[model samples]
Target chain A: MTALLERVYAWRWSVLPPITGVAMMAMIVGALVAAPREIIEGEVQRLMYLHVPAAIIMYVAFFFTAFASVMLLWKRDIRWDAAARASAIVGVFLCGIVLVTGAIWGKPIWGVYWSWDARLTSTLILFLIYCAYLLARSVAGPLDEQAARYAAIFAIIGVADIPIIQMSVRWWRTLHPQPIVFRPDPALPNEMLVVLLIGFVAVLSLATWLISLQTDTERAAQRVSALRAEFDHREIA
Target chain B: MNVLGAVVAKDLKLAWRNRSGWLSAAAFSTIAVLTYSFAFDLATGDVRPLLPGVIWTTFLFAGVFAAGQSFQDEVDDGTFDALMFSPVGATSVFAGKLVANLIALLIIEFSQLILATILFDVALLTPELLGIVLIGTIGYVSLTTLLATMGGHVRGRSVLLPVLSLPLLIPLLIGAVRATGASLGLEAGTGPWMLLLMVFAVWATLAAVLLFPTAAEQ
Candidate 1:
C-alpha cells in the first residue's frame, strides 16, 4: 500500500501533467476536426462534442473527490483530506463549466437556457448536495481532516445521484436526448466530435493542473494557520 | 432503570424550574405559527390546497426551536459529560430526551394545529383527522429530536439545526403533510407515504440511539 501510494504521488507529480496536456490536445483536435457537421434548430450542432465531454469530465472530477474523501476517512491522513478538498475545487469548477456550456447549447436546442424538468431538477439537486459538501468542509474549519472524513462520507453518498442524473433522461423520456456520443450511430458526425474531444481534453488538463496547485497550497495554508494560532496563544499567555 | 429515571426526573425538574427555558419553546412555537399564518393566510382561497405544507413547515420548525434548548441547557450547565458517564445506558438518556422533546413537540404541534385551522382552514379536528395529526407528529418529533442534537452542537446553535435538517426532513414533512391533508378528506394516507413516515421515525430513532453518545460525550 505504501509503495502504491508513493507511486501515485510520484506519478501525480511527473506523469499526470504531461498526460493531461496530451489529452487536452487530443480532445481539441478531435473536437475541431473529428466531429462532423450536423444541424440542430438550424445551426451546426458542433457544440455537442464540447458539451458532452465537459459534462463527463465534471463527473470524473466528482469521482476523484469521492475517492479522495474515502481515503481521508479510512486512513485518517491529512494529505487525503487535502486531495479531497482539491478535487472538490476542481469538481465545482467543472460543474460550473457543465452548467454554462449546457446553457449555451440549450438556448438553441431546447429554446430556453433553463427548464425545471426532472432531469434538470436532479442536476440542480446534485449541485445542492455538492454545495452541502463544501459547506460541511467550511464548517469543519481548522479541523479539516475531521471535516474531510464526514464531507467525504457525504460526497460518497451524494454521488449515488450521479447515475440518476445521467440516466434520468433514459429512465423517463424528458426533453433531454439519450446518450448521443457513445452509441454506435452517435447523433453527431465525426468531424465535430473531434473538435469537442479536443475542448474536453483542454478542460480536463486545466482541471488537473488547478487541483494540484490547490492541494499544495492547502498544505501550506494549514501549516501557517496552525502556527499563527499557536503564536497568538503564546502571546496571550 | 433507576438511575435513568432519576436523571429523567432531574432534567424535567430543572426544565420546570427554569421559567424561560420551558416557556422559551412555547414562546418560540407561538411566534412560528403566527409567522406561518401571516405568510400563508393571505393566499386563503382554498387554504386547504396548501394546508399540508403550511402546517408541517410550522410544526417542524416550531418543534426544532422548542426542543433546541434541551441540549443548550446541558452544554451551558457543563453537565453533558457527567450525564454521559452516569450509570445508565445511553439509550435511556436518549429516551429521556426523546420524551422531553416529544412533550415539548406535542405542545408546539397542538398549538400549530390550532394555528393551521384558523389560518389554513384545514378542518383537521374530526376524530380520524386528529388521529392522523397525532401520529404524524409522533414521527415528526422523533426525527426532530435526533436532528436537533446534531445541530445543537454545531457552530451556530439554533440557526444551524434547521438548514442542516430541512433537506433531510423534506420527505418526512411531505409525507406528514400529505397524510394530514388526506385524512381531512376521509382518505387514509396511501401506503408509500405511511412507509416514508415510518422510515423517518426509524431513521431518527436509530440515529439518536447511535449519535447522541457523541453529543453526550462531547
Candidate 2:
C-alpha cells in the first residue's frame, strides 16, 4: 500500500498540472460560451459559476483541514499536520475568492458591495478564523510539535463553531440568495449546470494541486531544518 | 482539596490579589457604555434599541480580556509547566481557569449592568437577562480559555487572542445580543436565541475538554 501510494505521490507533480490547466480551460469555455446568459442577471449572473464553485471548494478545503487535524491528533503524523496547514492556507485563499466574487455579484444585484447578511457574515468570520490559524502557525513556528498539536485542536474547535455561527447569523438576518444548486428542484438550466460542474472540477483540482505542492514544501523544509540541527550538533561534538 | 478546587482557589486568590486587572476591565466597559451613550445621545431617545448591543459587546470585550489574562501569568511564571506536569489533568486546569475567568467576567458584567441601569435610566437586570448573561459567558469563556491556552506561548498573543477568539464567539455574540434584546422586552421569542447560546456553550465546553490536554501538554 505504501509503495503504491509513494508511486502515485511521485507522479502527481507531472500528472496534476496539465490536468488542472485543461480543466480550467474547459470550465472557462463552458462558462463563457456554452451556458446561456440569464435573462434577468445577464453577465453578472455568470459570476455565480466562479463564486459558487470557489465557495464549495473553500468549504471542502476547510473541512478537509478539520479532518486532517483530527488525524494529526489521533495518529501523531507530521504528514497530517502538513496537510492541515496546506488545506487551511488554501481554504483561506479560496474563502477570499468567494467573498470577493460574491461582493462583485452583490454590487450588481444588491446595490451595495457588502451586506451584513447571514451567509456573508458567517463566511467572513470563517475567513478570519483561518487567517488567525495561519498567523498562529507563523508566530509559534510551524515546525514546532506543540504548535502543530495546538493548531490541530484549534482547527477542530473552529469547525465546531461553523454550524453555530451559521445558525446564529441566520437568526440575525438572511438576505443572501437561496440555493440554485444542491436543491432537489434544480433551478439552473442544463448548460449552466454543466458549466458549474466544470467550474467545480477546475477549482477543486486547482486546490488539490496547491495543497500537494504545499505539503511537499512543508516536509522538505522540515527535512532541511532537521539536517541543519544535526549538522550543528555534530560540529559541536 | 482536589486539583479542580485547588486550582480554582489559587486562581481566584491571584485574581483578587490582582484586583486592578478586573477593575480595569470594568473601567473599560464603563467607558464603552458611556461612549456609546454619548455617541447615540441616549439621553433623549430610547436607549432600549441600543442597550442589548452595548451590553453584549461590552461583555464580549471583557470576556476576551479575562481569557487572555487566564494563562498569561501562569505562562510568564513558568507555572503552567508545573501544572501540566501535575497529576490532575489539563481539563481540571482549564475548568478551573474557566471558572475563575467566568467569575471575574461576571463581576465586571454585573457592575456594568448596574452602571448601565444608572446611566441609561433603565432596568437592566432581570431573571431572563441574568440567565442569558450566564450562558453567554459560559460559551464565551470556554472557547476563549482553550484558545488562550493554545496561544499562550505564541508571539503577539495579546493581539492574537482577540483575533483568534472574537470570530469564534460571533455566534455567542449574536445569540446573546438577540436574547438580551428579547429578555429586556425589546424583542420577542427569546427561546431560539437562548437555545443558540446554550448550544454554543455546550459545544465550546466539550471542545475544550477534548482539546485542552493537547493544548497544555509540554
Best by lDDT: 2
Q: For candidate 2, what is the DockQ-based docking class?
A: medium
User: What is the fnat of model 1 with respect to the true interface contacts?
Assistant: 0.02
lDDT of 1 by residue, A193-225 (tens): 556666766777777787888888877877887
Query: Relative to the true structure, how large is the alpha-carbon lDDT of every model?
Result: 0.64, 0.87
Model 2, A1-237: lDDT tens per residue?
989989998988898899899999998888788889899988888888888999989999999999999999888887788889999999999999999999998998999999999999999999999998887777754467888888788788888889888888898899998897899989888989999999998998899999999988888877887788789999999
Q: After TM-score superposition, what is the CA distance of residue A168 in candidate 2 from its true location, in Å? A: 1.0
Superposition TM-score, candidate 2 onto the true structure: 0.95
Q: Give TM-score, chain B, model 1.
A: 0.82
Q: For candidate 2, what is the DockQ?
A: 0.77
Predicted structure 2: clash tally: 0
Chain A TM per candidate, in order of listing: 0.79, 0.96
- Tens-digit lDDT track of model 2 for B8-47: 9988998888777778888888888888888889888788
